[model samples]
Target: MSDTETHARTQAQPRPSDAGATDAGPIQTGTAPEAGRQLPTNDELTVHYPCKYVPVELLAGFGAGCWPCTYEAHSFEEADQLAHPNLCGYGKSLLAYAMQPDVRVLVLTSCCDVMRRVYDVLRDAGAVDFLWLVDLPHLRGPREVARFRGELRRLADAFAAWSGRAFDLDRALASFVPPVPRVDDRVTLLGAHGPLSLVDTCRDELSLPVENGTCTGWRLVQTPPPTLGRAPHEGSCHVCQDGCEAGIPRGDDLDHFLDWYAGALLNQMPCMRMVDSKARAKLVGAPGQHGVIYHTMKFCDYYGFEYLEAAKESKVPMLKIETDGTRQSAGQLRTRLKAFDETLHGMAEAHEVVTRRRGADGGPTYVLGVDSGSTSTDAVIMDGNERIVASVIVATGAKASRGAQNAIGQVLERAGLREGDLTLRVATGYGREAIPDMDSAITEITCHARGAHFLAPDARTVIDIGGQDSKVIHLDEAGGVLNFVMNDKCAAGTGRFLEATARAMELSMEEFCRVGLEWKRDVKISNMCTVFAESEVVSLVADDTPIADIVHGLDMSVASKTAALAKRVKAEPAYLMTGGVAQNVGVVRALEAVLGSSVATHEDSQLCGAIGAALLGLESLN
Candidate 1:
């Protein structure tokens, strides 16, 4: 079969690692050299490249050390000052790293608009001693390959002149090594490029081998086509436009090596930026592939579009994540990735065998559930009859475990029972794992689905707007989660957004909600960012805009974002609202208008996750 056909069929087989495992080691920012590669002495210069497209072998041939420039900045202040604030987190972080004194010479690619702008800004500011921007082609054609080959030659000559070193053909030829194949069942990350930190977290959290198919994650190497029995027609090679009768040219042959190198880089699975990105289908459809974690930058529109397309075409389940490319979102990303893993490989089932409480004979038995969240800790106690014995809610001060202890203690005290009185304890929420005394932990998505179904038996969808995240869950009649989506990395559609808005207006949440519900004007808030929205609100207040109208606009903004999220997952009705933000009448009304349907909420909506956990505990005991 032709290489293209083989590649198409290879989707049914395991894919090889992007770069060989040895070559694609952990990204390094410091002068510490990578393993296997020669370490650079104080007198020697190192060439730092951001993307995989840069020819590291060529750099090594010139007697220069090649280092993958990946580092997490302590702050984006330096980057923001150099580049636009709206630029991608990865770009900003790269800029920040480039400004450091150690980054002497930098090589970058014009892969994306952000990178191009970064190159422009850095070059203009003279951030580094030497900088080169390689012009990458989007397609694997003869002309493009020749063009790239010339660019590579130019790059080599420029580097040689700058460092007073000459390219060693023998060394460059010897550096070429074939990649080994990967065979384990793994998850593939697609969409915008991710940093090493995010990639490592995905691997660790999912506890599965993860193959990075994103732009920044994988590097392509040259693979030759099979030898033909007879001379083929000119330009008949299916993989590349170069029409050589022989297979891929070896690096030892200088003239053919450049053509081979260009073909090799272009023939690999194309990134989302490429016009023809169908090669990604193989990555997503590879054998032993469990799921996909589609990551996109917050301000990047390119990968966002690709994510939607990938999600639609993917055979396996997929999760979409957006980040600003900062460590600030690490905790949130962990929660989502862990929850996705649980969904794919079902969570460990609670033991069927039940242990009775001491003195259970002729006495009431109880179960407990605690939900430790960002804003509040909630606990619920239920009797053997499935009746609520007591419930408590309190602010979740700095520590999750402490807040959990306090909330559970309050409920247990109210029920006139000690901790030992409970048969089982289940924890749920963002801080679920932090609670030490809990017997089991469940994601809020599952708990909310169960609780919503119990509260409103006919409910088909649940919209949960919590302190720091928002979730839309589709449920079956039996309270089982069918599917769900969450927005945890941002505060745009969460209770925190409302709280921040209230603070900016110098009004209590209760007052803000009340005023918002009473507004008659149709004011709109365009900005979804918490900080920017607060400033917009301040400006409106200063302009003598009615408080009610401004509050209404803020409520509408949250509702609009929530509605869009719900639509993404094909939300059905009857709709039930859960989590803290369910208490806001204005938001509920605005959501109804946007969704064109009424949303049901009860007084105990905020405690739904806790209630669900308690119910699960009772189920396990039975």
Candidate 2:
């Protein structure tokens, strides 16, 4: 080994006294331990695979102890011997484990902000030679399989560099199944962890093959594959059914599922609050093909981000479902799992196919995107080849649908096309719901992310200020929304604020931009509320404040408010500015100054939402 490797070994390997010790409190692992139990050797270069609490199937493909799996530590003191009192304990523990010699690689999903920061720490620490972070998008359907395959290929290249072991997909797939000869009669080492546990308490008390590790309360006690296939044991789980259709009793409550995973009672993975980027890279990268990513609460922003990162690293089909931990949702979860299982099974043999509406004589298709805003509605039309055909914008009124229809009609008319000629229509923005005729409605957050991504693939941050609100979104390379922050509580420096101030100053929006650029002195607008700020501006004018200086102060105020949102979302550059406010050169300058980086804005910034909606429609067709 090189000197660098030797140095790492000295700092990373645990002492013999630390045997069977876990970072998450005390673990019982000595005399009563399972037969032949052993920890990965320090010299073996084990990778830490931290899953978001799922079943054993995710760990099936790789050889045992090739990676030492552990649920993340719950607190900082347990994780890092000298962690700060106020620091997020989850990140600390994951990081502490990552520094060990047994952990040469760290794999994790982007489930939350904590994980993202954790990843940053791991990469900056320079302990691991190979670090990869996967940005997992919302896995609602099968198209994600293609995305996963591409990510897996990229990961294989990285693994080859770190481990000097080339990944063979065929061999990997074969290994993904359990060692048992027949899957039909095979038993599974199942565990109920993460969101599943929250949803199903009967994880234990089930007759599964083996139940070990954290988040398993229900145990699979038998695997007599031969005779068991016909008439499996019942009465083990009267609550959640243990995934056996026959075992489900008509009047039984969902609590039987609780008995299915009994091991989780032993320990649980770290909460979203504790995760960070290094932990994510380690946990997400650990899985072989056929990994299951568990995303708990749908509204939980932290875990949501972590799920995204994990999805990015996945090599096989992954199933993501949300649950509120209520028995009422158990049936839905079961159905979702059934669908996921079928999809995973067919992913390999299934030929690539595109679904589209039949065209006249089988001609090409076209997609249209409409972005409805408080101020205006814009439309962008794209052909089947993803090329822009025409764009249109119309002033918005009380009725957003009318404005959208008018914009789309104008775009179609400009292109000399008919409404029936379009194959898909996607609508996006705050007023998206108002346009009920759209084929689909996407969140403005996603639309803006995609639009910015399409415009500049390198852009990782987007700062958008529209007529009524301001937003900051962080995106991965492929234009996936990592997370975002919106000024939904109040309108401070939005276009409306600018317009009101411009009117008070007797200037047009264009003049406001020019006036701010000529300011020689800095002025402060302390109040951010529109009415109060407007009054302050009027007072400043009456007090002989320079028109240039006052405008400069207004621009500064806009930057400060928007910058606060950027900080909240952990903004990184290159940034793209969208929405109506992008037309103001002075505000852009102020934003750049506050952000300490150059900002990119296009002439069609106001049309980004429409363009994004159109793109999504096109993607859906394919």
Candidate 3:
């Protein structure tokens, strides 16, 4: 094909819209309807496909709208009841979407086993009017392309008969839209395809250009070679039996188009399902790529393997997030994304400058750092010399913000200083943003690293178990966060977990911390889930288990979980244990046994995050 011919062919093709579109044309695939585009009427059939293997342009050529199967269910309760509980969330959500009244036709591909099961369930329930399962070839070759082309033809015939619309050769050719080229630096999502909600969150919250390179988002279609003008009276020419009508190709050219289409579909960037997916490295290591946000669905093994492989290949910072395709985990997702953004952009420093009020006798200026945690609020006040002037820790009753304010007020009173006496106020922790009084907010991971280094200057690893989450942070000598790992959305090895177990045993927090110190009997607590662990503890208590042995088991379980997190980040000692849990002697001893090393703890371990926040505030003044 000549350059002129290629250019002309490409210009004739449609430009794909921003939705989940194939290279051939725009396909609306997100949860919400596209702006200014009304929903398809009853007569206007819409075909929804789950994977890229489906021939989307063919449906568009048949006068039916092409849409990708992306749906966000309010809850997975209905899907869990219909499908197996172990089914992938995306597959379950897709099945739930199939039952919706708006879903007219569904085109599923044999991409994954869960999707195939979803097809069976939807078909058995008679969910949609039309359902077709296209057999997607795992390997990309001429033979596979030819086989896929046959399947495309079968789908075309079925869809045409169902919609009462004939496929127009000109329309199909016109529907071929070129892929948009990305020029600017952007973060690429490189693992299993995530829900549209996640994509939107990354774009909106991170405030960075994002490229979807996941299985569902990567659309790779090669531009076809240009052909010479056709002659009239060609075989089965619907446009003019034609040498050509309106300088366009006739229906006789459908075979050639199908051959090209088959090659294009097979030639897309190989998804993780492919036997060899080295091509994925190009997407991850692309020039101008800033970072990678790898998303994986729960119970999906394919993407997890891909993520591990990609993480090894990509040089940029990568964050792995796992979601169940529901909004329940949105908060945790936002936290991880925000911290990743901070790491990329260096936004943890306090941006606002507060005028330092000099002491009446020329004493040093004071700064305050507040850490509003799920269980407690800690405040630290430091002078210009980095010496702690005052500190306070208070129970975070209901509102974290209120607890932070109360702690700050108490610390200021103890320091004999007013709010104006402080040069800057920095906040950290789960409720950092809620503390409006703070000049700036930083993630607890960064703050914890800083605090741990300040307390134990030689410490290279910091393990912090707060009320709701447990995090293991590896740090450099200068207190920079090298890498970190935290427990998932579940409260497993956190302070809350211990509190729950203590409540189940009807033991005070002080008593609970000391009961397990001398325990020698082997009382194993197998369950780590907060709810299940509580139940197990209750059963043990009912069976007349010794309180010391039961407490020891609970402490060991917490230590095992925390130690695993520490090992994941390759934590090195001298290890510093911080956060409220550090005050628990039983947990500290248990952790020491698990790590086979002595752990360091300071008198103000609970105030480390607040102290780190204060140091950041002080640095901003400098």
lDDT of each: 0.75, 0.57, 0.75
Q: Per model, how many backbone clashes are there?
A: 0, 82, 6
Off by over 4 Å in 2: 1-355, 358-360
Model 2 scores what on Cα lDDT?
0.57
**lDDT tens digits, residues 499-577, model 2?**
9888888998889988899999999999889899889999999999999999999999999899987875568999999
TM-score of each: 0.81, 0.47, 0.85
Ranking of candidates on TM-score, top first: 3, 1, 2
Q: Identify the candidate with maximal TM-score.
A: 3
lDDT of 3 by residue, 360-420 (tens): 5565678889998888999999998999999999998899878888898899899998887
Worst 10 residues of 1 by lDDT: 8-17
